[model samples]
Target: MMTVTRPLTGAVVLSCALSGIAAGAPARAADVGRSATHRVLDVQARRAGLTTAAGGYPGWAKTTAPAISVRRSAAPPRLVAGAQRGIDVSRYQGNVDWAAWAATGVTWAYTKATEGTYLRNTYFASQYSGAYKQGLIRGAYHFANPATSSATAQAEYFVANGGGWTADGKTLPGMLDVENNPYGATCYGLSKTAMVAWISAFAARYKQLTSRDVVIYTNSPWWALCTGNSTAFRLSNPLWIAAWTKTLNALPGGWPTFTYWQYTDTPIDQDYFNGSYTRLQVLARNHA
Candidate 1:
């Protein structure tokens, strides 16, 4: 599940307000012992009207539905009871025929909208609006770059674009794509302590702006290596695990369960939202 990020050059990184670390730059081994200080923002910063964190729990209880299965190259695994189908795409899935895709039974879609402070996906507008126009529940995500930019700044950039939320039953909550740093070090050349603080700031700022928690997308090794195996986000941000295996292993970050599983990358980044279609609608509408 460890994917290499597209390397960013110094000029691009500087323009984006990201850390100065060059892609493939070496880091001192003693970085492990470094400490970081972060200013914690108010959890309830913006509104008395938006959905509180407690109210935002994705209702995980199963709803009755016919099982839907995907055939792997070998054979299709039996569908997990109550799981619904979806996919996530970036500019790489250029000019998607969203209607035709949805006709194949995809219920939801997450499109990459922004990365770091300035890198808006070239296809985000078309893909995001296209998915919604096709009657699919759509969400947007920001690929995190805590090394060059402060998390709050990047969160601000994400929300100002297509990543904002509404109570209308169409938009899924925004996601924080905090995995291996695409531009620099695996953990963005940061200490585990710094990485944790960066994520905290990003999540808090996202909540302040959108009044909804951002879904956390990561794999177990990245979670452990980058965030000191932090579970602080589990209660607020739903987990979207990236484990492409025959069997899922124990999840890191102390998550009791996952909300989405990205199972494949070939036919596209196919996934399962952990509930029925009706429950998916509830999750979309829950953001006040």
Candidate 2:
């Protein structure tokens, strides 16, 4: 690992090492030529020609990732043994009938809370509270806009709004949704090294504030493209992998298995916890 501190950028020190690049090297196409995902994201990134990036829309990732070349033919099993059902909700899912979802066997959920360092989920109280009322293990997520603000600042904003976690069985630790930039450059205009630093900084800050490691929600392709598949957060952050296949195919580098898998966007970003309901409670209580 390499220690990093920039002249500006609000004291977000970084210490993660990359495969083939120096910690301070400028981001370039050659730096991220590790996989097909990297190549595809690079092409789309150049084609997009975006000058800036912004917006922390919760569910925009699925739309942006299709341009990348990650089509998994094998359908992931709809039901896995010892796994619990889950879902993610946002204002777009407005006034969600949590009771309706719970009745369908949805036992866990994540609600969109904050985006970047400015916007708050307009319906967070209703959504976050409603999921718990429906007897589901629910949590909040921050849609990361790495280009719009410092990662630490965004993490602070998220916790100040709705990202805080308690030891209660019903509330899950907060999650960070880092994926393809919806409004601009694919990697938020940050070099892959800087992207790794940004995420490390955010995770560190969230843990410092909440005493819990934030769950990282991301897809494999975007992660490879933006962060160069860095393994720095694998040990500290539980992964909530967003693979829209019928089941999980290839996971991002580092994690041997996923804690949560968002399997599809249809029927509302359905997911499955890779454990039993009791284990789910363990996760919520920070005992796992």
Candidate 3:
């Protein structure tokens, strides 16, 4: 595994460059055509308190959600020698060292593609393709913003930017990162029923566009509170559970088991496919 040298405490950036960030509060559709660099800058601005409760990259929801925090493990488990090791990155990671990661046994990755109806990852081009060059199975993910736009609209936006799925065995299905609202409300102002409907609508639209089932990345408690533990997607969509503990525990939304487990966040977010390398290939080919 890639040896992470970053400290255990929350990774903090005390200062941020906010010169490119928009002034005051955000408009309903201010992100429509902004540059990807500026989009990432906006997230940094929010984290630095310029935009307050605006938006963030993936795993941002882990902070403000319900009692989901636990004593983090020193390192994520290996399970077995052939465990399918992986990592997820956003513009926050900038350009990555895929070669070093591959040398350390990282065989797959998910690169953040888009958020809301706009704001794509600035480093997506490099990060997504760089992993592929290293012979790693890679895919894209969209951080959900249910309050800003329709689920279908966001899904279309996500796919259009870079979340598209390919049948190639190295290309996994696109993922929807739905969790606590990084903005104001805990559930993005949507009630439990509305949240479930929103997710279902997004999944259906994504499938309509790609003819592939979408993988959902969410926290268990957040899922319970936001979707009322809806079981509508139990069989169809694959689960990518975010639980940063030593071992996996109770799952959310009636999913019998998790397909992908995001078990930690230190130097960067790390994950593992639940099955073997061949099984991971099956999922990539949309067979699993």
- Cα deviation in Å at residue 146, candidate 1? 0.8
RMSD of each: 14.2, 13.4, 8.0
Worst 10 residues of 3 by lDDT: 28-37
Query: Candidate 1, which segments miss by more than 4 Å at Cα?
Result: 1-80
Which pairs of residues collide in candidate 3?
none
User: In candidate 1, which residue pairs clash?
Assistant: 5-182, 18-148, 18-149, 19-148
The true-versus-predicted C-alpha distance at residue 60 of model 2, in Å, is: 2.9
Question: How does candidate 3 fare on TM-score?
Answer: 0.78
lDDT of 1: 0.65
Off by over 4 Å in 3: 1-55, 61-81
lDDT of the structure predicted as candidate 2: 0.70
Query: Mind giving the per-residue lDDT tens digits that candidate 1 earns over 127-203?
Result: 89999999999999887767767998999999997899998899999998876542334577788889999999999
Better of 2 and 3 by lDDT: 3
Arrange candidates, best TM-score first.
3, 2, 1
Model 2, runs deviating above 4 Å:
1-59, 62-80
